[model samples]
Target chain A: MHTDVVHNEQSMTPHPAGSARHPQAGGRSPRRMTPARRREHLINTALRLYSQQSLEDVSIDDIVTTADVSRALFYRYFTNIRDVHVAALSTVVDELIGRLTLPPDGDFRQQLHHTLAEFVTFVETYATSYTALLRSGSTIATSTTDTLVDRVRDHVVDLFRERLGHSSSSPMLERTLRGWIAVVETTLLSWLQHTDLPREQLETWLTDQLLAMITTTAQHDPTAAEQIRHLLAESGDEP
Target chain B: MHTDVVHNEQSMTPHPAGSARHPQAGGRSPRRMTPARRREHLINTALRLYSQQSLEDVSIDDIVTTADVSRALFYRYFTNIRDVHVAALSTVVDELIGRLTLPPDGDFRQQLHHTLAEFVTFVETYATSYTALLRSGSTIATSTTDTLVDRVRDHVVDLFRERLGHSSSSPMLERTLRGWIAVVETTLLSWLQHTDLPREQLETWLTDQLLAMITTTAQHDPTAAEQIRHLLAESGDEP
Candidate 1:
């Protein structure tokens, strides 16, 4: 998730003559964007459109027109529409990682409650883009470094590690986290389509789901499960 | 896994024209197909192309050309290319359900080992089509009755219910099965892309993972878990 497709697009942007930022030209009615800024502009433009529409339904022309940039300018930064989506998707992944981190406050369940709510909000905000990413067989290419999904998996793992006061996690633990996160992702996607369920109930449902999986994973991998069981026991000790 | 979409497609075939049992036409060269057989022919044609290429890469022109049908005739059944893909996808789902039925075996673990091996074979046979369906937000439309994914979920849930000697399972049991199945589905999709792992090892890994999830879910919902625990104890008694 913390990777380079976006940077690649930035590198690809043609350094057009007038697009360079100039202090002297800044006083003009319309300011020229620096090449880097133009690339960011295009990514943001693409992301905004993607947040509301399906990838199949979205057009390159729709993106460029909304950005008020010519096709030539759009082509300078992205060779294909998928490039723009890839860039936007990486950005969403970054935002997701940031929001998912939890405070060392409440008990394990409390922390989960807090984190799941934030997770749900992020999905709601980027439902369109998130849907688009999930629709791709590889949200971010598997060949590409660790996946954006892996990034989310890491966030959940870090919380478990932190809660358990463990320096490292087992492969079984990692697989459990990966599987649990996939469930959360799939369930959230299903929930997005069916919003009839109230928000609190949905949050409770997600929290229960995560807790249930952790409780289950523990039975198979007792060492890791023991750590979590101890953590829950200790969380009760805190207050 | 016991479901209706595939059966529904089979039933929808019109018993029209000479396509109906043409015992006499059997000797005729290039004999006319009944409406049901013609639909089946087109679906088979589409499935063949889908097996080799991504859905977007396959064209309506490609389907008709492969089937040797004109554009007008193609419209006689399918509304568009997606329609053909959906029909073909349902057929694949039926094949999957048929292959996944469990046999009375050594133990629960032994039965799962047998089922997982068959499941992997089905995916290996239909890798391209499976990939295409997973790329869709829902493998089968969530709105359109029970999905192919849901069908798999039912298979797991039914096994659990039967093994436990329960007439019905809890809500949590159902959710756990749904989530575990999603994990299995996600893992299989990933495993398909990275085939370095040996098939037997992959099957063992998947079986273990499913067992782990069930164990964990049981810990949380002890009513269902107790039933499984007792079943395992009795399986020991059997031998």
Candidate 2:
């Protein structure tokens, strides 16, 4: 039905699994969806609820009702609200990672700008989902398995490792990378609250912040400093 | 009475307000001399509890019972557990701020070393309180007032300003500083999770991470960067 389409594309949050227009956006009759489609439909609906409320505050009924699916349909995919939350978060993280790609050719600063530009736009679009996810404190209830935040963090760590591909591993390097990620994260988190600041400015600041942490870390740990400098030399884009 | 002192000084977290060695460590004769002393006593007790639990998880009855203070006596200083939490957090924040004394005389990096060395030691002693307070997410519940984390953050911001005491204000500067604080905080939070890392190494990494962020920010925001460089020039400790 067009109602489901409109509901799905409600500008609050669109179900990622469904087609952009939902084919049913213009009509009022509900369409029959396969099991996979139903799961995506439920997730997109749950994401909307999550964007509006904290993870603990949303309900299974809220998700089912929003998706226009019956409780029986909802139960087919998820055993509890926690599973839905975890899946919804996974979708967001996947979407975030999928959208990002970094070019290895350019000044490190320029490379940073290219990556952050994409990230900022993403943040602009899903500011609500991003907020709720961080407010979840990088975790989910009822499960100790890796959450979306953990996966995102790993992706970042991997990206940094790839960038510095030749450098030998050390605790200092690990700590520095983790510290830089925290800076980038908190910087973006606070930036979402103050959108008055230009996205261009936020990008530049974040790029610079990461660079600064590296130099600062280098000051105290000579071996790390040397190893990082060597990596930068090999990269052909040393700052 | 001695059992109370033993319980309080169990070393998971001792009162930051008290000397590292509680003069009353040898034997406990619940010394109740004045209202000020009693408030400190209660806060110290609450901190030990909080180290083991979270801010929201602790209760007034838990605190009063632990301190062996009657409910009537507890009522004299605080109206709720929230107030006690805020006050106790302030005490820890004050102790943290007090130990740090950055001389305007050295290289900025060296000064950072001095400041962070003190911070790391403070963190080591009060790891639990530091974790709980930050896990409180830097804002107390049930009120919109400043939390201890806020005060500590402000202190770092102020310290950054004084270090670049002569630089003019810019949004870039502001963001960069906040970014550094986030790095410091998240770095410390994660460090607590992996305590086998030497304290000296942690301090070095944090200091380097902060310095790197400032430099990186300068690279992107040239005006602020130039102003910062000029300030360092004036400080006679340019690297």
lDDT minimum window of 10 residues, candidate 1 chain B = B1-10
Error of 2 at B138 (Å): 12
Error of 1 at B218 (Å): 11
Angstrom error at residue A142, model 1: 8.4
- Give every collision pair in model 2: A1-A29, A2-A25, A2-A27, A208-B216, A212-B212, A212-B213, A213-B212, A213-B213, A216-B208, A217-B208
Per-residue lDDT tens digits of candidate 1, residues B1-239? Answer: 22222221344221222244323222322225677777887776666666567655778898777656678888999898777777776776776676676687667778778877887777776776666566444333323323655666687678767765787876555565677677777777777886755778656666655565555556556665665675445434211
In order of appearance, the predictions have TM-scores of 0.57, 0.73
Best by DockQ: 2
Scored against the native two-chain complex, candidate 1 gets a DockQ of 0.14
Worst 10 residues of 2 chain B by lDDT: B136-145
In model 1, pairs of residues that clash are A216-B216, B1-B151, B19-B33, B19-B34
Indicate which candidate wins on TM-score: 2
